[model samples]
Target chain A: MDIKLQKVTKIFQAKDKSETVAVNALDVVIPSGKLIGLLGPSGCGKSTTLYMIAGLLEPNEGRIFFGDEDVTDLPPEERGIGLVFQNYALYPHMTVRQNIMFPLENIKVPKQEALSRAQEMADLVGIGELMDRKPKQLSGGQQQRVAIARALVKQPRVLLLDEPLSNLDARLRLQTREEIKRIQRETGITTVFVTHDQEEAMSISDQIVLMDFGVKQQVGEPQFVYDKPINLFVAKFLGTPPINLFAGEIVKNKLLLADGKKYRTETQAPEHQEDLTEDAIRAMTHEVKVPICNVEIMDKKAPDGDVVIGIRPEGFVVDEKGPLELEIFMVETIGRDTSLVVKDPFDDNKSYRIIIDSSYRVKAGDKVKFSFKPDKMFVFDKTSGDVL
Target chain B: MLEKQSNVKAWLYLAPAMLLLSVFTFYPLFNAFFLAFLRDYEFLLGSARGFTFLGNFINVINKPDFGIAMKNTAVITFVSVPIAVIVALMISVALNSIKKFQGFLQTVFFLPYVTNAIAIGMAFAFIFHSDYGLLNTMLGWVGIDPINWINLRQAGNADTSWIRAMFALLVYTIWGGLAFKIMVFLSGLQSIDKQYYDAARIDATPKRRVFSKITVPLLSPMIAYITITSFIGAFKAYRTIIGMFGESLRPPGALSKDSLITIVGLVYDSLAHADATGAISEAAAASIILFLIILAFTLIQMQVSKRRVHF
Candidate 1:
């Protein structure tokens, strides 16, 4: 059940007479026997892509293939794809056993065989004793397990789940996500799961495809995508308390702040700026160097133009005699680490966040200075929003 | 003082409906039962009415027409209610699957329930006419001769020639009664959660199995409701049948020497033509019997409903 989606796109005509591109030119190949997650923010088309893969929704363009068979035109039933809806759409009238057996019966499986398979699925999902209970009689988690069993009983070639654990409470969601991963591994079935929660996706998926605003932002292993995000959106979307971005320019090998403070960087500066006119180079230099500070400069170069620097909270280290100073506005102490909200010296209206050890004492109104590891700094072209 | 006032205000809120129910519903039911047990008495003659328990009841059982009328009512109710419910269920399922013009189709099916029964009866009479009837004309096109449908009022109509007209009248009555049942069934269908169907499809349950296992069971409450209502409606099939068949005949052995009659028809006849004391008493007894028969059917239906209802 190798699921492949080629150049898939979906445009929805909203009730307000506007067209929303739900999935734009998306392509992904999910290998059989792996649990893959499509993760993104709300309205990012992750669920739309999953629905298209399940054959529940028709994409405006592109094709889907399961194994060697092109099933883009097939209906959900004909595609032999098992789908678990977000709300766990279990038949309310049927008992757990009946719900699990329903699909087998539909495919005209022998009654005795269907019953045995249903019982086996029910046991696998851990609802064996609750076989006689109707859906409404079961708890939310129990009902969800029944729904999963019902989907799996048919032995579909591929399984599609649309935010299956989203309806559960926090503790249950965590428990169910683990159980789903275990089941996927045990069955060795190709599964596509959709969720807006990055943690859930990272925890369960063998590979993750992160999406934003109908476009594929990045796709890789959980750690790979998290550590080396393809763009700012992916970087910000994957982390808790997103990465911090600053307005700065690169001059020679030093990154210059908007207030003209020069910070040394190991990153090589682009070579084309060496040919700029004297005035242009001077203007760039002035923007990088602070007028108030006769600060010690380890390196200097003619600044070229403006660039935005991004830094994750974890990237900054608080130290005495650090280059950047800040006034602490709020402190959040969470057992493992403490997050500090400090005012930005470069912009009066803005505040930047920094994470420090939980043992460090920091309160509102405390003044602190921070220096970031030069190698960890990310400079982006401000106008283009591309990494520089 | 505040709590006392709150209690008083609660009672005030409930007072109107309570008063209305006592006056309109409870009072009449007890009064009907009490009237059924009363012996011969005359208010105009200033004579005291005395209690005679089971006296009128026994008299009703003795009348030969009583058995026949009871059998006729049972036949009509049994034949019409289940058929109406089955037809309504089919129509409702069809309406549910129709994506386009669904509202229009629903309105068409529902129109009969709201339309005047007299009008429906008249229209059906024309369609079922022995000579220029639409049904007979269609049958003729298919190489079948005209059927005197209104004259075949028995199960063995081919042999029981005497019951042909009555049976036709029964069919006409059933047709006139179908609109309301269909509307009820449609509403019931709409109320079912669509998730069940989706789950069934995912499970690979065939369409027919889904309908039987999920749709039918979930729809039991609606089926029960329609069954009771249709049965009651069938029992009250006088206006439609009489309107179609014309109103001149009376029962075969009426004391007033009439030809065609029903229990209610006998009551009307007794009140209008025969002013005899015994005749009036007998009519009252027949009314009581009709009431009891409907009551017994309803009670049995409710017991069955309680067992089968899903929610």
Candidate 2:
């Protein structure tokens, strides 16, 4: 089933009569049979969005639909959704087989048939031999598999997983995530996975929806969203060692770095430029106040205004005679790549990091002149955090 | 060599508790067993009489009220304890589900547990009175005749009427037993993860099925605990019965033998009535028998729990 949300909102009321908007007017379209990741940090409403889709939580406003069927008021079971909780909530008293067969019990399936189906599910999850073992007797990963088998035995139209790999050890998390992806593919259920781990989401999900503070930030193909983020938050959230941020401004159609140097310019539209209007762009650009930290001036000429520069770690190209100069503060060789921890020579506390080839023998105090790939640079209106 | 020294240190730490148990518990327990095998109480007077083996046991068994007391105790324990556990389980499950005023309701349910059992038993006695009691009045509202309860004790009545008096006692016993068990089961239910019920709800399991399959099995350990404790408690029922029925069966103004009695009551009666030479032996034998019965029941329950308890 294709899951669609039309301005769904959920407000949680507190004991003192205050209210928290857990999911604020969220809207998304989860294509049928595709694993869509709801990625965000803690308290970002990703889990709330997933739960609303699963019908475990009702939206305070707006409508939810599964393939054009209005299901805003439907309960979880009636919505044909299988949800695996964060802790993999298996019934501790039951054997693996019994846990898998639990959903079948109330449906009047023949006892033998239900048992056989449960066995099949266990085998599918590769725990067939452990059918008689209680949940407490199983290892964490094994118990996780049992929980998945139990959720899937009913053949739900949509599968909702709320941080399913959060409870596993690092090695098991990777293995079980692959297992989950494989199972979802075999079943071809419309799956909505929620997690704070951007790497996991990018690796496993076909589509990733990044959210923050109860608002949707970006939604697109994982690589597409990563390569061309719509906002500052998306850029900051999607990378390992994180995208390096520095304060800068456009001046006289030239990019100005914080150390008082004006790099050459070539005017270019941001990746999300088509969706923005001239007035909206002006309003976004007019809001930023500049020159807060070290700035890498892109070749792209933007209107003269305060902006935030986001550069992916790999965006740096080390050159002995490049235009921009950065004094190397430290060198960290992390197996595959060496990270050049550089700081503004004028302001020592304003440090900027860039990754280069580990084979490059760079040392601290070396002043390296560098230039950036124009496409790798993300220009954002500082105040509104919108890509410029 | 160091492990041996640590072991001795651990034993030293345990010395006070072990000594206390040996003096107060183990000594009395072994003495009871030895006394059960003897019929002479001359030791109480600094005189010696050899063991009479089964004589004391036979003497106590032959007393006419012995059979009545045993029957009464068996009936009350078997009937009231199970009913108490079931009622408490249901109430606790219901209490566990609701959030509105849950603490208030729990406090209300737990009130009787903290209150004196004898006081509640007396209140229940008034409620179950024959002519003008609260129970008969309620039954009378439904057109049932008022019962002969306390009157049956003062003046011997037909066998059927005596059963009514016993029924009155059962009602009080079960009511008094409910509060503590309910508190225990409620806490157990509260400690269970809410996620399991959410999972069951998504599975669309029916209410009754959820209760039997999820709630009951998950609660098996607590259930076993409540059941064994309740059975043993019922077996040792003393103050509640005495409070519900007056001191000597008949009230202060009446003229008859006590109609309602239990094993403890019979043991007390024998201790009070026995000639000086035999009193201690007879009382010890009766108590030893009661202890053995309780131990046997507890062992049987433990065996059942081994197979069924989930945790």
Best by DockQ: 2
lDDT (Cα, tens digit) per residue for candidate 1, span A94-166: 7888878878877889999999999998889888999998899998899889878888888888888989888
Candidate 2 residue pairs in clash (backbone atoms < 3 Å):
A266-A299, A266-A301, A267-A301
User: lDDT, candidate 2, residue B23?
Assistant: 100
The sequence of per-residue lDDT tens digits that candidate 2 reaches over residues A121-172 is: 8898889999999888999899989988988899888888999889999999
User: What lDDT does the true structure give each of the candidates?
Assistant: 0.75, 0.83
TM per candidate comes to 0.85, 0.91
Give the interface RMSD of each candidate.
1.9, 0.9
**CAPRI tier of model 2:** medium
lDDT per residue as tens, model 2, B1-311:
99999999999999999999999999988887777676466645734377887898888898787887788889989999988899999999999889999999999999888889779978887887676689789989999987766554344443334576778788888888889999889889988888888898889889999899988988899999999988998887778878877667433333333356788886787667656777667878888889889999999999989999988
Shift of residue A146 alpha carbon in model 1, Å: 1.2
Candidate 2 residue A370 C-alpha distance from true site, Å:
1.6
